[model samples]
Target: MAVEVKYVVVRNGEEKMTFATKKEADAYDKMLDLADSLGEWLQQAPLNLDDEQREGLSFFLAEHKDALGQILRGAAPAEAPKKAAKVKMEKSVATSKEGSTSEKQAA
Candidate 1:
């Protein structure tokens, strides 16, 4: 027999998600709370957004809260995308080098 403990986040009597660790579950629940608040804020904005658009945008903002915070604090948003692409390319090159079949060429 095996023993397992899982943390579940439930909202409105529905199980939203389950996690192996309490930290992750708590983080997810907090993000949901942020998203809900953002949704309400969007409703009061002058720009007209449908329900789905507001919900999607709210979640996106919550998920990228750290990056958004940086932008809000005067960080240059344009720089991050190029740096992210470069890092991704570097990672791919490193992975390919590790799987190289021969000294002359990669597998």
Candidate 2:
């Protein structure tokens, strides 16, 4: 007699995929979960973003809409698109130590 182990991925009571290892199955499940979360978050994100952030995100999404669709649909592209550069903010603060004042700027 032989024993077999099955790693199954089930969604909505239907078997979606099977893997030989638990790790593979778990990774797939996590990916699906993350996609679902991302979809929900994207739907709600615009309301919370500032005008500049929204515009940047919108442009990025437009540029990568096909890749994003493929990812959300459970397909991986051969190469992921490069991320946009982050905007830098500079903050200036003045501090006084022992009757001496100095200003510091951080970016």
Model 2: lDDT equals 0.62
Give me the displacement of residue 82 in model 2, in angstroms. Answer: 14
Which sections of candidate 2 miss by over 4 Å? 45-107
Against the reference, the lDDT scores of all candidates come to: 0.91, 0.62
Which ten contiguous residues of candidate 2 have the minimum total lDDT? Answer: 84-93
Residue 76 CA error for candidate 1 (Å)?
2.6
Q: lDDT, candidate 2, residue 95?
A: 24
lDDT of 1 by residue, 1-107 (tens): 99999999999999999999999999999999999999999999998899999999999999989889779967667777777799999999998887774655742
* Predicted candidate 2 versus true structure: per-residue lDDT over 1-107, tens digit per residue: 99999999998999978999999999777766665554556657647776566555655655466788878866575433322112111111222342243233321
Per-model TM against the reference: 0.69, 0.39
Candidate with top TM-score is: 1
Off by over 4 Å in 1: 77-107
